[model samples]
Target: MQRAFLPSFLLLSALAAGLNEARAARLVAPATVQDTIVMRLPNRATLTLTVRDAAQLRQLKNYHLDSLTTRLATYITQAEAAAKAGTTNQVTMRFYPDKDQPGQNLPEEIRITAHKPGTDGEKGPTKTQVFLNKKFGIVTTKDGDGHNSFSIGTDGNATANAREDSLKREKRRRSASVELGFDIGLTTLVNSSSTASLQVPSYNNWRSTYINFGLFYVQPLHYTKKSKLAFTIGPEFSGNYIRLTGNDQWVQNGNRTFVETAPDAKQIQQATLYVGTLNLPVMLRLKLKNKEDRTTLSAGIGGFGGTRLTSNIKTEYRLAGTDYNSEDKISGTLNLTPWTYGLQGEIGFHALQLFAKYNMNELFKEGQGPKTHLLTVGLNVLGF
Candidate 1:
């Protein structure tokens, strides 16, 4: 890409003048030295580099700009000396590579047309320019342009291109063919069907943990090109672990299911109800990006419906002979509702994902057990 290298070149030249930019800008402490210097180029352009102090006079000492700054500094000094001596009208320097340039004989020359101090009081060059042709141009170093070693001037769009490229790379790295996610959250019931005679069990808020594990294959249905909106559908194999607090275990007597004192109620530690289901979720996602800044934010809302796969109660017991560590597993559906469905949503930026799910169906069939809706909330810590 063709660019205005001369502008940048002249800018660097002025930077190497060792002028105290900081001292020059102060109003009270006027500098003894001429800190504010200006150079008029033959192409009719003016370049300036302002700083607060001489601390960073050289600017970037190891980069291409530094090399150019040092070269311009040397050239200006020589040109001034030549103008004062009346030795010649101009000074020119041919740059040869530190290595070899196979067949090139005459290297690119930088010419500065010097002028003797006139009665009008001209102090510097009358003209200055870098040659650009088949044979004359500034040589970029082998370590130049982010180690590409072959770029000139600005690739004008380099900044924007870099950001977009990085964003694409991150998206590619985050893509998943099959997503397996785990949910770590707390569970609570709403609108409990508790009566004075048959009170529903109260759960320990902190101890009642709700966990979910799901495997899914996301299929985008309406993701248009260059669009921020997307609709996705996926089938997920899901498992739920709902823990209960207190000394009660699930008991199915005849046609109804309820919590009751177990055979070893005093020895029981924790009880959990486990449920498994196969769900189909349809999600509407809104994705956004700032191409210039290389940033992204995303959020999603979804609904899922599925039928029960399995249900069981797992109880932990503190036994006398053991170190308060004994386990019991009871396998039964316990009159849990056959159908399950819910609303779910998530919001995230970059790598963090947070989600919430609520089940609208009662935990058990009507007239069989307590009627309560399930709600789970937590962070989707791993994959999505």
Candidate 2:
């Protein structure tokens, strides 16, 4: 009888030792910020676990060891299963301390939730809850709202979503845009022939006005992330008015052009010439700042070439100085060039733009009239 009892006791002792070894194998050191725990699930998926605070660290190291690990492993399995099934892989788990033992040195209630992929099969948002004290807890999520009860996904996808959003905004900003604007400028004759007797319009009496209506298509040329420069090209209708002093009218005799007092006119009041053209303008516009506010500084330089559409001269005179009521309107090409080309520049602060233009081509055909260039200066009333 004694020998049989001894054999049973030894067998029981051996079983107890095996149980102790297994328990020791499962135990681990408390988690710290420097340590990251990685668990490989049965489905060949990985779950990375982290401790956010001291209380969480203590709970992970001590209380409900088997229960917590089992729950986490189950969550990992479900996430993988959802991924394979093409469904939402989100999982939420809530933990609460045992209510029966109020004085126990155990952690308070906590929640862990993982987000699922969005419609595009990418991870959505994540949320983690940590109890800092018995009465307070901290919740964090990729979205600003932290009060959400469930965390849907992992944090690995937050950065990708942010990058996608940024790209979309940039694409919208770089899109092509069209704008309408009006241009007005002062004009004068330049680079005239020395031998020509045609008097240059006096600065005091010669009033040059350029009025243009245009539609511009602008494309942004990005040199840097914050830099803004644009290429602009458009078509415009321009009407140029030049008022010559005194009652003089421009006349063309064969190959010579001259200005003289209008025939049968006494005391000329006003003599004006109008030239209309259709212009194609190209420009480079630069902004000193990235913002569109009116306080920013901007500059532009460009050139234009076009064909003259019409030309006319108007004369107003005083018949023997009797109230100066006579008026005459004439329409002709006046030997003006059929085509025109010029260089233009603009500078402004915000919406106010000042412009200047220098015509490179002669105002009239070769040997047909006085050789003169046109210069224009004025303001752009409708900012582009």
Candidate 3:
């Protein structure tokens, strides 16, 4: 019993370890420089200041409109620069007081003064700073061309405050992660009446099973927390077995014609097919967070294109349901036609998912007498 259970135990243990590592990676922060705050005075002079994460976003409520504006402008400028440099993952903001501002009814303005992460002559690691002026509603980055930078909002004070609060909340959820993982799954082909003919109804029963394995990479989009994109590549193999039974009589012109020399009934045929496939799957994954911790609701749709590498078929026929009439085994490529397309979906825990796929292509090439399809259900594991 221990010997038989060894493989299952090892596979389960490997799955658990891989999932933990992937989850941990998601918590690590991508490398980035600290953000600086800046504000441009109505007098046209720019002032530099420091406002931490929450403080920076609370301008509409805690700080003067001028102050918040400075920080907001600096924040966005720095964010854009960071993205261009491929250093930061994403940047966002929330403007509050949402209603129109009273004082703003008059011509008033504030702008960013300097751009942070200033262009150091050399083009290597340059540190940018943001200047924030609480007194004047201006924001500037280390890179801005002039003091008339940009305004965070002309909305009501309350709305401005709300916007700042939203920005603070968004900054907290941001993260960058890298993952690596694998999944092993199985698939089976079921027998159906639509695929068989009357003469071979009993002898042409067919069913097949397969084992597949794969690897994947995943990246999440900040605009939508529910979805991510992933690419998976893998190899798979399948074993097909078929059984057929029929009356010893042969049919002619849709008429039941019995052979005088043959017995009333017999086992007509049996066959086995073996094939291998190489697949590349691309998919968009949607995830939902549950109220519970360490658990996530996940689903995805994947499209795969693959080619069959090897396929062989063998068959046996018996007469009168008793004596073997002929037996043949062929190693040549059966008309798997080499191409397959499918869509898959599933729900699962972090890094470990289970999905089912329905192949859209016919099993045989065109002009073949009968038609067939392939269906697969398998476990999908992701690392990211």
Global fold similarity of model 3 (TM-score)? 0.40
Per-residue accuracy of model 2 over 31-144 as CA lDDT, tens digit each: 334433444333333333343343443333334333433443454445435544554445655565444355653335545445554443444434444342452332333321
lDDT score of residue 354 within candidate 3: 80
> Candidate 3's residue-wise lDDT over 1-384, tens digit each?
334433433432332222112111001111331333343333443333222333334442333333333444454456556545664433333233222354432113322112122232212111121212332232222212221222222122322344346444633433333344444454444332243342212333224345555555444443223333343333433333433234332222222211112343544354445556777777676665543433366677777788777765545567464654776566544545668777766778765678787778766555331344666666655433
Residue pairs in collision within model 2: 114-151, 114-152, 114-153, 115-152, 115-153, 116-152, 186-377
TM-score of structure candidate 1 = 0.51
TM-score of each: 0.51, 0.55, 0.40
User: lDDT per residue, candidate 1, 1-384, as tens digits?
Assistant: 013244444544444332222111111112432333344334333333332343323322323444544654576567657777876533444443222343433223444444455333434223333332232222221110112111121121232234336435634433434667676877777778775434476666676666666765554432222224555566666666666666676666767777776665357788777777788877777655564533266688989999988888788878656676777787777888999998999887766677888898888888788778888777777544
Q: After superposing candidate 1, which stretches have Cα over 4 Å from the reference?
A: 1-180, 196-198, 215-227, 262-265, 290-296, 319-326
Highest TM-score against the true fold, candidate: 2
Candidate 2: residue 181 lDDT (0-100):
75
Tell me model 2's lDDT, rounded to 2 decimals: 0.59
